[model samples]
Target: MQSDPAAMPAPAGPRENRAVLVDVALALVIGWILGAAAQVAHWSGQLAPGRRHGPGPTGNEAGHDWPRWAEGMGQPPPGVPWPALIAAVVILLAVALRRAYPRAAFAGALVGAIGYVAAGAPFPVTLIPLALCGYAVAGREPLLRWLPIGVLVLPLAVAGWWQEAAVGLTEPGPYGVLLITAAVLASATMLALLRRARRDAHDRERREELRQAALGERLRVAREVHDIVGHSLSVISLQAGVALRVLERRPDEAAAALRAIRGSSTSALTELRQTIAAFRDDPGRGPTAPPPGLDRVDELAAALRAAGREVTVERWPDPLGPLPASIELAAFRIVQESLTNVVRHTDRAGAAVLLRRTGDELLVEVADDGPPLAAEPTPGGGLHGMRERAEGAGGTFAARRGERGGWVVSARLPIGEAP
Candidate 1:
């Protein structure tokens, strides 16, 4: 079964969801390990929840006497309490959104950082959320998200510096550094995935367009095949049947009918070959010379005139001058096909052909005194073929009923005025 074009797969779906889930789990694991390590290492000096020491330092306040958990300078210096728990949660959130809702995870990390700072979390623990937010937001969201991230950075950095000051130089603990690395990696990975998605979308669009064009071309070829074979065979069949039925009575008419059958069969064979050849090789690259051009306008007009119809021809001096072969061929085909349609469909036997150069444009117009076919509302393939020729040559073609009940086919080809 052919798939509906509208139901094609979108760029985001099940795979993306799975990736997000994995990222979240990984983040949670990382956060848990970090929190547990800090707690067990005495990083926050085991301050029991809601327990207050007797006498505090000079600047330390009564209720805000720097909880042991929140006492670290910048990072949550390897210790566990309420702060460690929150930071770990933030990490898990960041991981969850790494693939899917990156922006949400990014914002959540920043919020988690603030929560950790206010709750007197370890200095190292706070930095984790800050790094996560900065890395996440900068890559995906607008730069405005950076403002809040920037606000979080100041406190986190200060705390880190304070801790470094408290502990002597060369305190190479993996606190701020690890968070920065993780954030950078996350941002890069996110950007890479985004780029891949865009490229995939672009490829899909291109393929769809080509597929549509190819289908249209196939339909056109089918119609042409019908016109060539069906029309020819129908004419031959009718003539042969007439000839067979009237052979004993109307000898002369039967002979004429037999000749017409022979003629139609020959023409059909030729047309069939041409149609099959077109399938194997594009005419543009074939040995066949391009179609007729503006020079043939008078001949086309004369042919119509000879058939008991009046034809008038107007030409701009050298409008057919050394033009690109493609343009010349296109203009010729447009006028030829238009004239052929007039011959086959219109009641009027004659038409006028006009070709003029207006500045940088060439205009070809074929107008007939024939009324539009009210019953056959759909435009025929001949007219469509002419329009395609004009458009393929970087021009515009229009065919409409004229004010005087006649029909007009006009095509404008923008030119560069041949040197």
Candidate 2:
């Protein structure tokens, strides 16, 4: 048994079908220009007016006197044949296909021009298709290959010889119209080249923009992982050490230390999975907690307390209403990273976390009574990640030695329009 070919759905249209429609209109206009010019006169000596040749074309006959020097010699036809007219219609249809098949259209038109002369046919009209085709294909191809298309102008000049025979003419002479034809083709080719160049430049800029956006996103994810996993691992290491030291004596205290380790590890793994899923664009994974924000800063301090470090938080003009999500996230991460650094780099040092808000800005500061902080960041360092988050949120960041002792980290983030 055979399947029905017509039953299959048609393939979707090209991405740029709108351009193809414009080409159809351009094709019709070119067809009219050539069609109107072909009907202007018949220069064949046998068909000239007052000759005995059977019934010359009755309309649009030329008023100029025939050249005296060419009384015997033949002149190229000012009109084209029926076959040439049909070829032109086919050429016009090809012109409409220019958007999708520009090379084919140009090749067909070039072939038509060369075919007319190769068959010994005489006419100025045959070359019009080649000039029209140049608008679409000439500039798109290499210069060395398409230059030959300009050679057809010689025959056009000879066919227009009657323009020279005209006496007292205000219009251009024989080569004047020829110059105009060449000018038209040249203008078309130059314009095509310019458009192609502009499109190429736009493509380059778009690719660069996309590359930068991806880089920024990856850096953002790295900062997130650094802050989340770094803080949790610090607490786990401290709690595990405590549990091992008291395993034999003080069993209850050891059990409590182990429980803290389990809790810290579980929360860190969940947050890590969420960040990885977002980076991979995996929406179907397990539902995740909302991003940590300024509201979670107290939780960070409480965790540090569990790891046997004292953290004091002070807020002035407490933020009664919700701030923009970006500012909140940046502020929370700054505090979390500062505390983590104290835990990892110092021996049970006490820390202070401070947050304040103004009309349109939030200020976050963290200070540890430990040795001076030295930030020689290598890719995913805590100080660098905090600075990046602050600046990315359209804010400022600073890390400097405290006036009396220790190290201080501060950030200022603006509250922009919220979604």
Candidate 3:
């Protein structure tokens, strides 16, 4: 079975859905409690006394306790306990839903207000929920669409002036209109701010991802550097030692070690150039000329002799034939680096290098009879360099403690003509 290219994961919508649900449930519970409290208060008639004899208007509803302040007039008293309770509950539900789920919350507020009207709440009072719904809806929609919703309520506003749809309905005059208008404007502003906040969060996440990618690139560069330089210097050190020792006893042998050192140094310089080229981005920069092949092992051995390490090279004059550039470089570096390690780390008087070419491949071995040295850390800078050179050329690299306390570095590379 194959994987579908279109499959992907998304999370934001679900999280927002859950948040809205929790808010609505909380609003519902609170609205119920407030309504019940308002009913009990109204039942006591503690709001105002019965109509008694005389003055301007006895039992004037204007003297009763109003639930909310609007325009210039107070809304009618909540009336009897049950009616008052029901009205209180409606207002609570509207206010709660409007603020909580500003967009989706509008539905609940609208429903609650209509219920209050059915229960005989006054017109000016009923306007409370309508105003809240207006503000909330206006805030949730884009700027251009919000004003039309305000225009929708004009007919209902005009109807309040004539008579009580029930006993409590009344015109709230200029104050009511002004108050509701203010709420609509405020809601629109809040929505703009919420939109801005979301954009800022998205930008922050993008920057963090870029920072992590840069860090990874730097680490890869460091590893490649360690692989190239470490092994080359070790080989140079061993050859230098051989050259120095032979200088006193055999001028010819000393000269050999010096030659080997020079050869190895040249190889190191070439590898460094290739590494730098790998990192350059200019399209003009192409892969460099192929690296040295293993056929040059004799020259490598002579370099060690010049460095003062006793060196012996045994091989078919051209044991390793033509090989791929990558494989050739790998084999050369492996041999070069191993000899370098022997010169640098061993006090051995002499070292032996062997190259055996077989069908489609070549095996290289470097062993020394130098003074014993303790084991060092795995893939230390030098060994790591040798390993990379080998593996990169489609080969393997291994270095370990030898039987006589000396160390050996060996590599096997694929066969092909040298680049």
Best by lDDT: 2
- The segments of candidate 3 whose C-alpha lies over 4 angstroms from its true place after superposition are 1-228, 231-267, 285-287, 314-317, 372-379, 387-397, 413-419
Candidate 1 minimal-lDDT segment of 10 residues: 44-53
Q: How many residue pairs clash in each candidate?
A: 18, 0, 41
Instruction: State the number of backbone clashes in model 3.
Output: 41
Tens-place lDDT per residue, model 1, 1-419, is 99987898677678877766766676777677656744643443432222223446433333244534455464555523666576557766665565456567665665565444334444445444445545555555555644444444434433333433442124443344335645654565467457666877999999999999999888667755654565455445555666787899989878888777676678668756765675665656566433345676665555444333577878786545666666776776676666666656665446788888777788989888776545333567766777777787789988887666568889998776553
Best by TM-score: 2
TM-score of model number 1: 0.41
lDDT tens per residue, model 3, 1-419: 88766785455487767755764665566555545444433432222112112234322243334332222444434545565456556556656666455544444444444444334333344444555555566545655655444443443333323233332234354235435535554564566547656766777888888888787566546655554566557666665666677798888877877777676678778877877777678798766765466667777676555554578877754544456776665666666667666655656556788887777677888888865656643677767767766776677878777789677778877776555
In model 2, what lDDT does residue 75 have?
A: 53
TM-score ranking, best first: 2, 1, 3
What local lDDT does model 3 show for residue 244? Answer: 76
* Candidate 1 runs further than 4 Å off: 1-188, 205-286, 294-320, 356-360, 371-385, 400-405, 415-419
